[model samples]
Target: MPWILVFLFCLFCAPAQAVTIPGVTTGASASQEKAPPPEPDVEQKKAAYRALADVLENDTSRQELIEQLRKVADTPPKEQVPVITPPEVEDQKTVLENITDVGRHYGEALSSRFAQLYRNLIGSPHKAFNPQTFSNAASHFLILAASVFTLYWLLRLCAWPLYLKMGRWGRKKNREKSSWLHLPLMISAAFVIDLLLLALTLFVGQVLIETLHAGSKTIAFQQGLFLNAFALIEFFKALLRLIFCPRVPDLRPFTIQDESAKYWAVRLSILSGLIGYGLMVAVPIISNQVNVQIGALANVLIMICITVWALYLIFHNKRAITESLLHLADRSLTFFSLFIRAFALVWHWLASAYFIVLCFFSLFDPGNSLKFMMGATFRSLAIIGIAAFVSGLLSRWLSKTITLSPHVQRNYPELQKRVNGWISVSLKVARILTVCVAIMLLLNAWGLFDFWNWLHNGAGEKTVDVLIRIALILFFSAIGWTLLASLIENRLVSDVHGRPLPSARARTLLTLCRNALAVIISTITIMILLSEIGVNIAPLLAGAGALGLAISFGSQTLVKDIITGVFIQFENGMNTGDLVTIGPLTGTVERMSIRSVGVRQDTGAYHIIPWSSITTFANFVRGIGSVVANYDVDRHEDAEKAKQALRAAVEELMEMEDIRGLVIGEPSFAGIVGLTNTAFTLRVSFTTQPLKQWTVRFALDSMVKKHFDLADVRAPVQTYQLLPAPASGTPPTPEEPTL
Candidate 1:
């Protein structure tokens, strides 16, 4: 058994020895390279294998190693261990806490910066005021100033003639026949001339700088600072002059006394110069030569002076300015003038607030504040000016009453009035819109909102679309109503050279159509507007339908009234201006609606009677009317005579010019219709045109009385006398009948 094991192990070891290790040379190959080893006999190989097997069988360590190798081969390879990193933990601070922390951080930074500024301010002179440096800077500044002054003198001398000519021209133009364009043109010319002078001065200064080879910082700073200050202040003065024209009274744009104009111009110019020079030139030069802290301190002082000066000016002129604005408002009596008056009332306070805010802003963030304020102010002014101009134009154009052609006016008189009223309303709406847009733009300019971004965004786009749709809807609705009204009015009135007068039925139907059209148009416009404005009109429509159904069920009487009125109108039972008897009330129809009719009675009472309540209706003006007169005569008198009297009265009524046209036919007499105890009754009926019954009846009755008197026909009269019933039981004397 040991030999077999050894043999098997030898076989395995042989293949292993033949397999090449990556970096090792086998002993057989090494020997071949040198001298080949002598071949051993098979018996020697067997002897060597038996010896190795005996060693392996007796060695406990070898057995253990083999067992371990076998176990290693049997086991599967281990997989790599995966690494798991924990997710990053979120910060515990909320938004408000983070903001507070940021604010605190900025506050600490600001305080530190301010402290640094204070230290720099205290030490600035020590670092900045060496004698040599001071002398050098002063010498350079004086040289630059002298050069600039020389240049300015030369430029002014050269331009003096032109400036004088422009001024004279402006004055002469003002004295000429004034037009709306003249003042603006003169002011523009003056502004242009002033600008030309400024440009020439600046050009000369630039030439001087270039000629001097202003390479040194001191020279450059002085030239840049002083020249820019001059330009700014001069430009501002030019603007003031344009407005005030202090030297020329007639050229002044505003209506102010010459003394007042000159006063304001000079003072304002001085103030602007002080503020502009102090901030633009003084502070910058100080900072360039000394330290930024001193410049900042100087800036604050200058701002303080400006604020105080502005406040003084505002308060001093507050009452006068307000009164001027009030006078303007009274004269103009327009919406813009009213706004000016309101602004005038608060202008002083507004001015004070503006300066104070500017001071505070400069104190907080001096670098950007002035730029922001100036830009915002200019933009806001431009916005307001444009809006005001547009509004004024709209008002001027739309304020006039619309005049229609003669034919239209004659046919439809109310159309012109209605159109004019609509125009007035449109003007007001346009003005309001312009004001609103101006406010929005002003807010945008002042950084209150980002209007352009909002306008480009989805919400603003949708809003604009909705507004446009609403406007269109309203416009179309107005047009529809106007057309309907015009058409209906044209139908209602008589045309001498055109169509004849509309019948009562035609007029009634047209009026109803006009009202119905108005209601429908209004309903459709409202519905479309609601839908456009992002309202879910489905629910509204559904609710309206349900409500209408409920109303139809709940108010059947209203439905009945409407239905009855419609039928009555269609059948021409009664119309406006017709004498109508509805139920127990008798009146002339004054107005009619879908559900009710407005009746004005002879007693001056207006009754709104629903059609449903009209059980009996009689229209006296429909076709023809008959007036019946009855006269009773004495029993002894002949009834034929009374009939003859009535006939004679009707004849007389027909003879009258006014009543003759009203009487339609001859009178018919019923002789002796009845006999009473005292007299016999004779009835006669007169036929007349519709609506002429009352007039004809009154005239016929008067004629009847007169004719009866002329014919000596007597009506029966019964008389009673109470004889002294003195005796207790004496029967009363019998009443006697007298003719």
Candidate 2:
């Protein structure tokens, strides 16, 4: 062949390689030579050339690679529909490109679109690398995203402040209409502030974008710089508010003795503020830890907290539990006593069973390496299932065969209603939780873990991450909310053998505790789940600990209350309907509890006392009681006559058919105990039945009064006789006499 022909053939067949992108081609221009490639760059070129030659010889692999890249994002092109702006369609296309998951396409679809627009507005526009159509769409998409996100975030942020403002306005306008949540005022304030923030973020972002587009990069970057600064400021401002928000309502009145509510409010507020601060400062830091470390810390902290909380709860629960246990031990508790004893014994056994759950989920045996996971799984299922089924059956049997109380018969409808409601709720909740847990376990058992692994490791698109978080939040939030609700419900539904709801404060304290436990449990579950999927949950663990410590320090009263409650439970301190006295206050035990003791005075006045303050306890209804009395008689009668008459009356009283049975052992009369100018007093003594002393005394007194009236023996009435102030008007009296 001619040299010129050879040159042409060589140029054409040499297989031009600039990362030979299958069909796409690039010129070997001078600009491409500006920078030499990294090590083995020449080798890579030659290999690509060889591959190209081989593909030209046989095209299957090249075709496969081509197919894979194309299939990476199976996006549909935008179709311009009327009334729908280009920006919206562009947003749809961008979302399709960025988001990878097909399953979650329908999930949070609206939020995903909104987030897309937000990203487009805030994200950089790579005009050089991206195609014109795509770049334009992304930019428009970003603008929309920015506007929407700013609006939504701003509105939510202003909600509380708006509420406060509205509350102020409402209170000022109509003091009678004071409400905890001032809705009207809040709405108005929210509208105004929301508009303001939206306008500001948009205007600022736009101004920067436009400035950059018009001429100066420096000026535009500065504006971006300003926006960043604004974000920083907003963050700090939120922190400041968190730190000082407690003082916003000016809780100054609690210093007075009468304003106990104010005092407790102040304490709770301070505690809340400290907790918020702790979270704000520590959450971000702790969130960075790996799941294993976080898990270890969480395990340690939880164990510590559990141990501590158990100690406290035991104290609080002591009084009631001990009473319950004593009744069981003494065999004095009413109704289904055997059944109750059986259930309680089962409960103790079952409490130990909760830890077996960890074993069920364990992929590897910690205690015994020879233990096969399959065998462990089967064993766990068999044991727990059998135990649970047996427990339910036992409970059911007890419910049917337990002793029937007349008191319960009178309130049968109320009891029935309460029992049915709790049963239904418990069953429903249990079913749902079981279904959900089974689903999760099934997914883990199947091949979905690999998908989860990829998704969690930033392998999925940004949109997917956002969607996952939303789904996660809603999912975990639902779990959290459900667990919390269940806890509260169980507490309410469970039989309350010890105390009544004495006061609103005590109720609130109990509710707060129940809610706190629920939240903690829910959060820990979420963190643990996330950790299992490879999320670094160190920050969450650290934050939880710090939050707990802060709560412990700030809400020491609450902690004390919980602690006291446990002690009460374990010690069998007191229970409702028992008579007790603390300090100067004496009243019937209206409500006995761990957090506080309630005493209702004889006058129907109520006194609430924290259990921590109670170092000793005195329970009535344990033994016999004594009644001593002095009966006064008219001085017009002889003292001996009165004593003889009183003795005769007592003897007659004891012998009477209506009154004799009330006396326990005997009636004793001590004669002529006291003397007065107009009357003499006779002493009487009697032993009476436990808890029936007052009724017996009243009947006996009435009998005595009636007999005395029949006998013409009168009770003394003392009257003061006053002479006129003699000296003040002596001269006037003398003049009158002379006249």
Candidate 3:
């Protein structure tokens, strides 16, 4: 164990110093030229690692904090981070440059390696190109690629239609299975097509490399080549779509999730450009340009497609949806709110359509189109602004006209629910629109319309663009993440029904989410932003992996805990509202967090438990709990008679005024749960709703005591047992028994 610790410690530890290259002008900051100065920051990072790691190592304390933080850090802020970026990389620009080189290199090398093999097999004077063999291979590749393209388009076209029809049919038949089959089938078909295309591309590549010539028919060879390339990309896009589409049961219904399918065009366009670029790069490397011009043109088309897709996402329509959750805070809204929401929804739909039209105009690039687009955009904005003002005025007037009279206000709840929902939805819309407009303004300043480079310059240009975009994205993401985490934390802790916090449950949950979300966002944002900014993260990732020594020395505990924490959060092993005992200490979980667990003892004190210490946890919160009751009855009564009397007592007690709701049912005798010689004690039990069992049992006891007195049953005389010495050290012990 110690050796393993040492090994892991050495694995992640930062070096003592970051040495400069002495004479390297990488064009970035010197610190970034390599990694930034090895910080004592490693120590801090290592400390963070250890904090979480150690928490996980000890099982005894884990459940304690889970209770405290369970509910605190769970909700989300209004907006999500645009993208996730990593924090570890120092020179994002250089890293992205490397990734571009890598993706480009991979695409090209794969193509070239086959190209050379083809030349070696067929170009040599020793061998003649066989027409029959060439024709067979070319035809096979062409058919396969065409099939793939067809599959992609068919799936893409059918997806939404299938989703709509399947839902309708399922409702008629009342089967959720129909919906799943509908989506999963299309997704699976798309995946199969992708798989076939890949297989065909590989087969064709092998053939081309093995035989240098495309037979005597250049046209046939070109047709086969083009089809194969096109099919390969279409399949890739389709596969990406299927991976992203949501069909899982656990996902919230009717909510806006990421449009995974819409983004396939991004990958397809990128892939197409890569292949086109593949011809360009590989030709330069191997000194051949037979197909550069055609491939380059195709690449341009791919870029154009990519740009259009991005535009679509940017201009997507957003309808006003009510925040059903806000009502948890118990705030009511007014009718002006409702009208504002409706107006906003209509306005946004129109605005989106208008923008889409602008996208089309841009695509056509008619004479003077750039100038026309600029003018049109401004004009559209003006129209939208004016419409919004008018709508706001109209909404106010309508609200004034429709106020409930005082008598009506006093008579109804439904009116308020409807009115409030409308008002709240309206406020949310206004806020969202304000954000959208602001984003547009900011983007326009950066010449955001120009974010589409893949379509403009093809693969070569796209590689550069992707990197720059990533960097720009990451900068904004960090700020947003910080802000959101703050808001959510405040709301959770403050609104917890006035409970004192550092709640083990809520904190545990929050820490889990925060650590995971933060890391993922950081990694993604860094990759994209750095790539966009001209850094290649690939080499860093590669070099990072090959060097076994560096990770060993750094924060071993930090990495271990975070990994464990991610799995724990994903599994949802524990949540709020549990009664858990760790070791001999027992408590109801008050709060939970990744770093520590908080347990609120039955005595009103809190115990903070570290996640690592939780080895043996006893959870009493699940399933139905037992209720215990004790009541004394007269000794003179027959034991059976006394039991019957107590049963009757409960039967009548349940009808009493004060404790009726709390009592679950007539109580049962458990046959002298405890014993004494002088008196009989009856133990009674009943089942009640979870969490209500205790109160019900207490109420029953009160009723039982009250009834016992009314029946004139003599109560047990309290006695303490003691032994001086049995006559022979076993003198007849009192034959006392408890009933």
User: What TM-score, over all chains together, does every model reach?
Assistant: 0.75, 0.31, 0.30
Query: Which order, best to worst by TM-score?
Result: 1, 2, 3
Query: Whole-model lDDT, candidate 1?
Result: 0.75
- Residue-wise C-alpha lDDT for candidate 3, range 616-718, written one tens digit per residue: 7776645455677777665665677667667776777667765566545555568876666667678877765446677777666776666666666777666
Positional deviation of residue 88's Cα in model 1 after best superposition, in angstroms: 16
Best by TM-score: 1
Better of 1 and 3 by lDDT: 1
RMSD of each: 20.3, 35.7, 30.1
Model 1 lDDT tens row, 249-269: 555667888888888999989
Q: What TM-score does candidate 2 get on C-alpha atoms? A: 0.31
* TM-score computed on alpha carbons, candidate 1: 0.75
- lDDT score of residue 470 within candidate 3: 50
- Candidate-wise lDDT, in order: 0.75, 0.51, 0.52
- Tens-digit lDDT string for candidate 2 (1-739): 6998985554343233222233222334234555543333555557656645655454455565456445433434343211201111122356666575554665677467545534433452433333553344335435544654575466656566654665456555444656634544444454455445645765656654663433545334433433433443343333333323333332111122224334434443443333222222222122222233333233334334433443454455445544555466455323335445655555543433432333222212222211233244444455445544554554454445233365453323234444455455445445444444444444444334544465457654554665456556645555555555554544443233553434333344455566677677667667766765667899888987999999999989877886986766555455556666677776677764546778998998998888667776665554666678778888787666666666677777778765677677777778777787878888888886656667767766876787677677888867665444457745533332220
